[model samples]
Target: MHNITNGPKVIGTKQTLRALNKGIVETIYVAKDAQKQITLRAQELAQSQDVPIVFIDSMEELAKACHVEVKTATAALIKN
Candidate 1:
């Protein structure tokens, strides 16, 4: 059984990025087929924040993890 809640942290781009910059991001998961620019930005953000990045098989999985319907990309920022 796959569980997004127990899997990892999840965040968006705009507001979420701010949180990430504040050291709230633990790990990030992007859709494998996400936009190149968005993915690149996420990569950069993760790198700058020293967070790990992973590409899941589908956006659906990422969305579900983010508690959305169809999110193209998402960042896992959990509070420690």
Candidate 2:
């Protein structure tokens, strides 16, 4: 969470999935409280690509880490 706050990242499940598919994500952060359907695809794709997945406690927590105003189900730190 601390690291993601200052690094290049993509927010939300869709954006994270897109980055993961493109092999640009180094690590993905998923909120444990988010709906499985909303986050499962990203998790699976990250695993397939060997990108690390870190689970935050909730969407609100993840949003704070990303410095976003709205709740986000997932986010990713992109490779530099």
Candidate 3:
């Protein structure tokens, strides 16, 4: 998504889950290549909250989308 690179965002599963619990995440991006255990809880929480999810091909790609240097299992765009 074009919005991910510049929008206010949080990267990695822990941070994403925190934002989701706080009700501030607009959308979540998950890397399919990541271990399921690493991403499962966040995905379930986002679904329960009705947040949209966009799947990325890999952790590296997700990092790139989030404009981060290190790979991440997930990232989220914070609600404006």
**Residue-by-residue lDDT tens digits, candidate 2, 1-80:** 36789999999988998898889999999999999999999999999998889999999999999999999999999999
Best by lDDT: 3
Tell me which of candidates 1 and 2 scores higher on TM-score. 2
lDDT of 1 by residue, 1-80 (tens): 13335755655656456667777777777778777776677678789877777777777777776676756466565666
Span of ten consecutive residues with least summed lDDT in model 1? 1-10
The lDDT of model 3 is 0.94
Sorted on TM-score, best first, the list reads 2, 3, 1
Residue 61 in candidate 3 has what lDDT? 95
TM-score for all predictions?
0.73, 0.97, 0.96
Instruction: Sort by lDDT, best first.
Output: 3, 2, 1
Off by over 4 Å in 2: none
Residue 65 shift from truth in candidate 1, angstroms: 2.5
Report per-prediction Cα RMSD to one decimal: 2.6, 0.7, 0.8
lDDT (0 to 1) per candidate: 0.67, 0.93, 0.94
